[model samples]
Target chain A: MIKFLESIGTNILSWIKITQGFLSLVGQTFYWIFFGFRKKRPLKQEPILDQMVFMGARSIIIVFFVTFFTGIVLAMQSAQQLSKLGGTIYVASLVSISICRELGPVLTALVIAGRIGAAITAEIGSMQVNEQIEALDTMAINPVRFLVVPKVVALFFMLPCLTVIGDLSGMLGGYIIGVNNLGINSHLYIQTAFEYLTLKDIYTGLSKSLVFALIIAFVGCYQGLNTRGGAVGVGRATTISVVTSFILIIVADCFVTGIYYFTNL
Target chain B: MREHKVAISVQNLVKFFDGRKVLDGISLEVYQGETFVIMGGSGCGKSTLLRHMTGAMKPESGKIFFGDKDLTTLNSDETEAVKRRFGMCFQSAALLDYLNVEENVSLPLREHTTLDPKIIRILVKMKLNLVGLSGFENLMPSMLSGGMKKRVGLARAISMDPEAVFYDEPTAGLDPIVCAVVDKLILDLNKKLLLTSVVVTHNMESVFRIADRVAMLHKGRVLQIGTPEEIKNSQDPIVQQFINGRLEGPINFAENIDDVNFAGEG
Candidate 1:
């Protein structure tokens, strides 16, 4: 019994050692490059296309269009409240700054993280519980490099691109409500939006998206890789991935934005 | 089968899981060009033994020999280099969902060979044909039937022309005809490639059909090693009960069901 505990401890420490080794290696070099890396097992592509389709392409209409209405509501409410202060015209600046600088990236990432990150977790968790990861290991493949690296590659790249698109769509919606119907003068609305949305504001929001992307990928993959039991475990992993990523995103958003301000870095 | 030489050897192997000794001091030998069978019920440490043999899991003590290479003493890179000379097919098939039948079959080849995709495609076609999956090159695992999935898995296993292969429950859960087909493939592969094979299976029919020699494990210990007929005639009650599929035996079900001892069950 004591020996078994000792072995488990050794396994964990050895696993840590292996992880450090892998992280240190630069892109695509292997000790067996000449001999052919036969231990490559199977490169676990982990449903990236399906995830992107559901999380990226399919959600495009809902994310951009739904948030478009959110932007319009923000503009109209800001206009009404500012009108009471005799500052209705500046509402354009307020709506654009808030939507463009904060609401756009964080909101879009949260929504996608809910949809896509949960799917990644559930799918991977199911695989894990089913002995799929062990099955992969038997074939001598590194499950992390196989299952994880690709998602890290895909989500890290895609979220930033999606954030840019979400912001443009949101601002367009605000313009439609603020100028076309609200009679705020379309030219002045545009001028005020440009003036209010500084480079710093844009960088802060997009920066948050990049960080949120890391959280979603890591949390989803970690919970999945550690999942035990069966289908119920998969369910728990998905739920945890969504809830955890959502909470972490909000908290990290505040912290990152605060860091930008406190150190002014 | 022709008389064969040493393919793999295990000496004084020991392993533990969750603070319990699962694979107690063990020793074995596998000769080349033979289907060496390891039989044990779930949790007897058959899979664990296989994992240690293949480098997926390391032993707590003792050594493993792949043609006298002393695999247990080797470093990670050294073990990997030796592992390339072998292939494994898992119980669940473990087909990559994103890959098609051709891509999955060609994976080991691509990983182990510098052949261009064009040549690799031809080799894949040949392998698929060998496994009776000639037209399934473009079909994903989700599109495959259970039997077809196993065939594709077999194709993938042989893709590298490995000197040896390990099959974990190869005929498990398949219908009789499918099981027969799997058995035939095992026989045919050994005949054609002269590859040493180690298979862990509980099915008696598969044991009789494919195994040249069988090792029966009981309670984390190997109780017998013999030919199918020898095993059948033996008076070892555990082997007799297992072979006949008798419900009553030393294997107490609900009594030792792991959960029975836990407080959470209530």
Candidate 2:
């Protein structure tokens, strides 16, 4: 009984330490961002541009395909029930609102969490294990400003752009299903989709993506910089980064959707 | 050599990891313009002491003075400024894998200077040439063999002509021929550039070949610090045993065996 209690206590303490370290990293990231702006010379632009290309442009095709199929599935499932009640026209509203406000942001983030998050963790974790990060430090380069800031900035700006593309693709997929397969009038389907999806819904989703971007970048970088051991450690950090980013994305989505729902209510 | 001014002065430094002391109140001085080698068995904290000296790791309770400025009292930015004066070659070379050889060597110059690209290219070529890698500029780090990677690492370390260079086991995995070549390179560079060097290694041959003075660390403490001749002729059993690679001495390999047996029993 005493041994089991000790184990629990140790695990809890370890969790507290990890949480504290993660929060400190978040704070430091923000500090560097603000301090760079204050100095009238923001962080370097070259690395940010490089990261934008990697995270944004390279990820578009995957995001589009996934979200498109998701929209098709969502419309197909909803149309069955709606058609039973002779209300097939409402499929446009359901698909548009759901895709624009929720599915678009959440699914895009999940894809990025798996793709870019793993890459960031692996790259930075390898650097950490091999002492390249220390070499940067010894050369008077702030690893956070030089490495993490560019990634954070790139993700912050690019996730929303990807989410917008996903939203469009999803709506288009729904249009194809609603008009062709569900026998709804093309004109009426298009009108119903736009009428229901207010700019506010789109704004809510895009804004939520910004928060998700922060979680992915921060968690990936935190796991990477703290990686120990060697190659095995890098692999572990990469896995943990993806898992943590996914969990945070889901949890943040809930809080964001809840707050939006209640405030509007 | 004994009358020369100190380049780095470490005083009463102490460090702990996981409640175990890794550096225990050690004091030493490295003279200007000489190769100071710290020799020890593995896990004896030579690398830890070197890290502390380079300001990469902070000691629990101590002061590290580089020239007159106390490194322990400096802020992060100040510490970074100080670090610009030193270059370090990691045991694994630690070359950035994404960059080609020329870019890797030119990194410090790119970060710290606004030199023209042509000038940077010229400097990169010159440094590479110094390390006998002038034609290997476009090669990635993965393309290089272990010896070549260490040479490239050395090229990058000296690209900025730093006032001091710290080498962490420069010949740890090299064959004897390559090790001898690296040792000769170190000697040539030290003489040509008149740079202060601090090398941490367990390689006995490297110690005698390159050291102007040797500091032997044993169990987180300075066992002795003297000229190589003095160290070789010293009466300390631990130093003699370590230098000679003897199996029987005050330092017991049997204790490690006993620990293994005890753990197996448990």
TM-scores for the candidates? 0.86, 0.96
Against the true structure, whose TM-score is highest?
2
| lDDT (10s digit) by residue, model 1, range A1-265 | 9999999999999889745653443133222222233654433344556555556677787678756877888888887888899987777778777876688888888887887788788878877875567656655555666666667657776787788888878888788888777787889888988887788888887888889988888778777877766788888888878998999898998998889889986
Give the count of colliding residue pairs in each prediction: 0, 0
- Local accuracy of candidate 2 as per-residue lDDT tens digits, B1-266: 77899999999999987767778899999999999999987677788898898898889999999888789999987887788888898899999999999999999998878799999999999999888887999999999999999999999999889889999999999999999999998988899888899999989999999999999998789999999999999999999999999999988986546434332221
Docking class of 2: high
lDDT score at residue A44, model 2, on the 0-100 scale? 80
- Candidate 2 pairs with clashing backbones: none
Regions of model 1 farther than 4 Å from truth: A1-58, B1-4, B69-74, B253-266
Residue range A154-193, candidate 2, lDDT tens digits = 9999999999999999988999999889888899999999
TM-score of 1: 0.86
